[model samples]
Target: MSRGKHARRRANRNRATLEGEVAALTAQLVRERKRLDQARAGARRADTAQARLTAETAAAARVMAPVEAEATQTAAAVGPACTVLTEAARELARCDARLSRAAGRSADPARLRTALNTGVRAHLDSVHRSAPLEYHHAAFRRRRGVDTPLCRTLNVGGWIPPEIAGTDHDRIAAHMASRAGEHTRAALWCWAVPPWMGLPDGTDAPGRRTALGATTTGAPDLPDGEFGGRLRAGAVVGTPWRHRPLVALPEDAVDLAYWYRRSAWTQNWHPHTRPVPFWLGDEHAHGFPRSQPLPPGTDRRLPFPAVIVVFESGWQLPARHPDPPDTRAPTGLLYARGHGPTTPPLEQPLYRLAPGTRRDELATPLELVDRYGATVEGLIFTADPDGHPTDEFAWCLAIHHPWGLPLGRITIPASRRATHWTTAIDNTLAGVCLAHFHPTATSTGSPGADPSSANAEPHARDDADVHVLDIAATSPTTGSHRTPAHAAGRAAHLRRATWRYQPVGPGRQHRRWTWVRATIVGGRASSRSTVYRLTDT
Candidate 1:
């Protein structure tokens, strides 16, 4: 036993004692934690049980209250007044059944009318006449009728008045018809296409109407007729049935008569100042040539978007159908056009007069030449190089260009032995000249031609480049409505053709760099281009 050895033994004993204390304390902490978890779980269970009791108490109260309320309602329904009304209703049903047996299956309408002279209809007629005109007028403007609301309110207390009950069908139907009318009248304004192409005013008024497409009650705001009130009460104006002509039309009117059918069957926008738009930017546009040599003064170098319209005729009938017997109705080409590429006239899928070939639409008015004489034509848009809007024939005259490409030519079959594109508009030639014609500085020499086509002319040689004009010296069918101002507004449309940075990379290039000139010809599009690639010489 040295002093150092004694000190080491003391240290070992002290370390062992501290280890025992630490192990005992850890065991006590574990037991305390286990007790805490158990106590918390017990509290949660107690809370859940209390909530369940509260919910069950509320549910029981809810269930009992309805049962008690229903019992009270049942007693009230069986009161003396209800008992009397129920007996009366049963009596009426018995009376009606007996009346049916006595009257036989088909009662004579005249005799029935005579017997029920002072019946429900008569009473309703008197009531209608007595109503202040303003009240009924509101029905058309608003969505309610006077008699309908009166009938409803009277029946609200579970008591059906006999008069209203007897006339239930008539009143209810009138109310329903009035509701059907509310949308169109309440809409403020909209347009519909008339079936007949030769209608008096023509077809198509643009956004001239209010967004709703309703009109301001024309002429007088108040009714002005022999029986306007009665008519208003009985009929809803602007409805297909109510507005239709009562008398039938003759066979000659059959084609135009198609408009009298249901509104849903007729054209959607019609009955306007004219079929073709009066103004170029109006709901329609002029025609632009796809390719042509400049007529005279036309600047060929100035690039602009060439445009044309593609639209369906009034009806989707064949490109050429039998003209109506009424020859006075102008059987030749009439154009019906509209504004926009949105919802363009898509001819339904049908068998083309040719076997197996289906053309969804007619490409141009020229297509109808041999058929119904290609009387009617329509165009959508047209513009020239100086940002000026010019139509097909006029474009050539204005630009000193010759009509090129397809040019919507109506070539006469050699068998017909007539000139191609001889139309009524070409008054000069009865004999065949060019199927189409354009005003030229040189004489066509065949028959009746414009004076401008004869004698020494500065642009006579330039007209030779154009196929349409070269066909004959006769003046081409220029736009009936095309004006110089129309071509002057070309800047707006030309802006649309300027180069835009397409979101394209070299990897996804559908096209390479090239000088491309574009034009919209009728509904089809074509371009003349010269491609170029970069190279180091």
Candidate 2:
């Protein structure tokens, strides 16, 4: 019994030892799992820190980029201004040195002031003498030998009543006064000698007025017993008034007349002055015939020529008379018809002059032929040849001359009989003549006088460059009138002929890419195409 009890005690002791070991191993496993969890959390924290740093760096970079760009731009702008200022300062210093050197030889201040004053006075006097005057009546009357009827009637004392003298003249005078007021206010008055009224020597004043009776007194005096005797015998009881004197209108009156007439007349009635019609709505068709088709394949590059056209003025006479007295002839009808009492009925007259005849002394109803001879190759006389509404004459001289060249001469007849037939000249002649006189530089040689040598070289080089480009492609992109090939050639020529460059690298090294910007002397580059090349240098 004592032996069994001892064995049980031993077994119990072994069980206790095994239980202690199991408890220690479980504690170690728990510590290891806690350390692993802590390690994972620490790794996550490290990753978050790194990502935040990256984001902050990117944000800082974004903030600094535009500032850097602005700084660069500021530097670029300041560079040119600084250069200009430097140049100006140098020029100012040079000028100061020159002034110092010239101080000893300088003119007296008083003398210089006096000379300047004298020059100013002379210039002022010249300007005053050449100034155009508002009232040029004296000039016109002197050249024309008498005051124009319109001018005479406008004068304060010119209007006369028939009761004061023996004639039914008030109606005519009133009519003339009305016409003059309606048309003469804006008329540019000037002097012109009428063909019929030969200007007397030393009588160049345009405002002079003389009584007809007094003027005729120097001629053979009428017999006092003839028409005067009949008046004295009571055949005509009242005293008679002499005929009114006539004068010529100015040459520029033709243009004024055209402007006024065209405005007053409608298109149908005055087709010649109407805006030209074009089927294609092209501006080049101006002054040309509506019926004429444009040349095929013609683009805006080629401009059409001005053509001669005609249109009509609507004017008609009364169809019937009011009474027997009206049938006898209305008082002042002669003046209205632009004829004298003794003149024949008014009719459109035509006369052809001999070829090459000088028109220096031609009268009314006269036409000069071949004034320019064979030089008048494109002589087109467009007018209302068939009495249509388009009743105007368009005479295009075949010869092309410069702006100042006199194209033709027209004479104004002084006689009242031919007053109705006044000539009208086109004002557009000024613009058209300017175009012909200034042809494209391509067709003509260098325009204007040759420039100074210093100024000429740059311009010549530029023109040469433009001439070498391929006109179509380069012209559009470069905004140049020249072709690309031409531009390239010009750039090469200029680089070889005029400018020099220095290498920026060692051992005669040239840059792989070199850009050249060209500008005209004393002028800015007109186009971006003026940049010659981005090339290997």
Candidate 3:
């Protein structure tokens, strides 16, 4: 009975100890719940901050998008706009200088005006003198004894009735040819209306109306079988208004007459009309043929002889005045078409050799003649037998001889780099023509030689190195490898020949000639060609 009572007392003490331990565990669980709640609040704040950062970054990108695009657009327009601005500034400076000079020369306003007018008239006369014969005579009114109906009517104060003038271009051209001595003058008068509005407004010092009665004279008739000084089968003819040359074809008298008649009637000064169709195009096939194609059965022929002109298509003069005198510069020729940007005409003229002509005849001595009565003698350069960039070479070689000489390399005043290289060297005539010094000789090593070595000839000594002279080099003319091996072989057989330059007159100083000798070494063949021999007159 005593043992049972002791056991009950111990069991009660143990139950009390268990109740105290349970209370401590419950307090620890509540503190853990508070910690979890604090951690969740911190996580929510971090997420909100992260989302705000992301939204700010997106907003910043959207703000910069147009700015970046605007920067890109501004960069794109800066180049050409800068060029135009530079040109305009130069022209303005030039005009200011001219005005200052004129002001200094004359204090009286009337005298200044007269001086300026006189200067302009003299300048125009000089330009007319330098123009091509066809244009020069027309502009200056070269006087002859005989007169045509157009000239007679003008001289007698009888205006050309609209009926006689005729609206059709073809009929107007026929009327101009109707009279013996008025053809060129009639054409010139027609061209004067739109471009030269001052032609009919001229009056004498007496203020009489007799100015219209004075007729511009004419020149002797063109020799039969000739259009522009006997159009050579492969020769090129140049005009004052065009930067390109017309490829002379082997046309009969009928074709020559057709060209003369049409060209005489056409007023080149008109902006819209292509004055002469010297080039071939779709219009040639369906409307008016520029030249007769060779008969089908004829043997295949090679490219016609031409002067391949090479120049930077993007090159331009810093400033150009709208006077005829401005056309005297080779750079000015680039703007001959007008102030607008120029491109190759859709129908560029092409010339090829007659099948009967010998390949060796390509180097036949020829002359580079200009309307300004300047002539330089050299061998004729043929077009690439395969095809050429007719446009590039046409402008490249069409630097009128009247502008200047030493044509190989030209450095314009105030320009940083030399802009021109007009020479008669074969396809290999690149950077060499643009070089500062004239090379005495050129040589090509072998066909398989490295092309980097190609430029070595123009810079290195001919004795120290052998650089490959591509029988055909990469140029505006033909492909790198298009020239035949036989062509190189033919160059190998060229005999050395030298010619003396004749003096202009006894009193005139004799001009020294500079020559470039080129040795082309092909497989099993080698030859020397006098590529360019320029007179420093």
Candidate 4:
């Protein structure tokens, strides 16, 4: 076409092309707007999800705190029973070692035998003093002037001693053999003194009869006083007989007076202490019959005293049952005579007094008043160094709190009586008040009065504090005229961002977040995010 025609045609074609380009651009713009809207919607949804997650995390944290605190407390209280068991095991091990050493040293058998014999003799003596027959027979002979030997034994290995000969010896030997073994017969020997006898030299005095009708003096054969008569003859017969160093009597006229005096003296003097009157019956006076059959429904009560004097070394007077009545006599002696000239005014008072007049009361004046008030009962007293009746020491005392908690122990000084009344009162009040006022938060397992049990808890409550964070995003972008510049423009055009988080519990859980700035190039998108989770204070 000519220059004019060509320019016009070109113009028309350019106009048409430009129009089409405009329409395409418009369509592209609309598409981009829709994508942006979609991205915005996605971002909103992400934000919503993150918010829900944050709420859930906070709720969980709230539930865990108290549980954690309880767990920590429980761990602290379970450590004492283990400690006691460990100590008990150590003590048992020590006792075993001592026993082993004693058993190993058996070389000096003679000395050991002597020691054992001495111990055995001591045990036998204790048995005799406690035996009922020893007391009853002694009483019977003194009253009737006739000796009825409980045991008739004179066997000495293959030889019979000259002192225990005749029909008496044979009867005694037969009776002893029936009760004990042949070796026992060989080891044992006996001598009988005619009525009104004395004990052998170095022998303990015979037990004295002290009741109202009991004999106090020697019979006709031996005129010297019963105890005095026994002191002179050194009677080895019925009184204080020894198994070793056999005694033989002359076959002819026996020295009846000599034996009588000896027996009397021996019966009067106690082996452990000076001569003292036997007041109470022997310990075995209340023994059960071995061979005799009892009627049905026999109610046997223990015959020994309930409270024995426990020495520091653990030896007790009358160590076993059937103890001699006069053994370990109290320093002060009081006789309970029938209503006669010797009886005291307080012996049987018509009305009970605040303090009973018995000389051997166990309780102290203060303990009786504080614990039991002023209701007076019969008292038992032990003598002081000077032989005066004194109050007894309260050995053990404990205080219980109102909630049954036992707080502490009160130790008293060694004395016959309590020094002051205030000590017991103060201890009881303080212990009870403290336990009642402050209910320990520690789970005391029981309401019983044991202070130790007042602070324990079961083991199931521990939790850790936590924080949460959730992030979500959606974006739409387009690239098409397809140049790097165009892509960059699209990337720059649309963007949505959201950050959400919550503390794990109602209390604030510390949290920190850092956002890393992003550098955009071309149409590509990138995000940089960081979160720092922390604990609750």
List the candidates' TM-scores in order: 0.15, 0.17, 0.18, 0.17
The alpha-carbon deviation from the true structure for residue 429 of candidate 3, after best TM-score superposition, in angstroms, is 24
* Residue range 35-60, candidate 3, lDDT tens digits: 99999999999999999999968755
Q: What TM-score does model 3 achieve against the real structure?
A: 0.18
Clashes of 1: 46
Once fitted onto the true fold, the runs of candidate 3 whose alpha carbons sit more than 4 angstroms away are 1-185, 188-240, 245-533
Candidate 4 deviant stretches above 4 angstroms: 78-537
Q: Each candidate's lDDT (Cα)?
A: 0.27, 0.27, 0.29, 0.28
lDDT for 16 in candidate 2 is 83
The residue ranges of model 1 lying beyond 4 angstroms of the native Cα positions read 1-108, 111-125, 129-537
lDDT of 1 by residue, 1-537 (tens): 698898998898898888889889899989999999999999999999999999868755754676689879978877978889999889777756644544566777665565455332222232365688775666544654333333112111111112345457654333223321222221111112111111112112222111112222111111121110011222212221122122211211111112121121112212211111111110111111111222234222211132111111110112234334665322111111211111121111111122332122222222222123321121212234354433221000000001111111111101111212212112111111111222222222334544333474533312111112121122222333222344553442321111112323577675221111233322223222222111112
Candidate ordering by lDDT (highest first): 3, 4, 1, 2
* Comparison by lDDT, 2 against 3, better one: 3
Query: For residues 1-537, what per-residue lDDT tens digits would candidate 2 score against the true structure?
Result: 889998988888888887888788888889888898898899899999999999868755654567779889989999999999999889777755544443336667665456545432212232244556523555657677876445211211111211333344554334223321122211111001111211222222111101000111111111212110011111110110111112211221222222222222211122232221111111111211211222233221101221221111111111111223434222221222232212211111001122232222231111111111101111111223332222222221111112112122211112112222111122112112111111112212245533323566432321101011121221112343333444553332212111123354588776221112232332233322111111111
How high a TM-score does candidate 2 get?
0.17
By summed lDDT, the worst window of 10 consecutive residues in model 1 runs over: 394-403
Score candidate 1 by lDDT. Answer: 0.27
- State the lDDT at 378 in candidate 4: 9
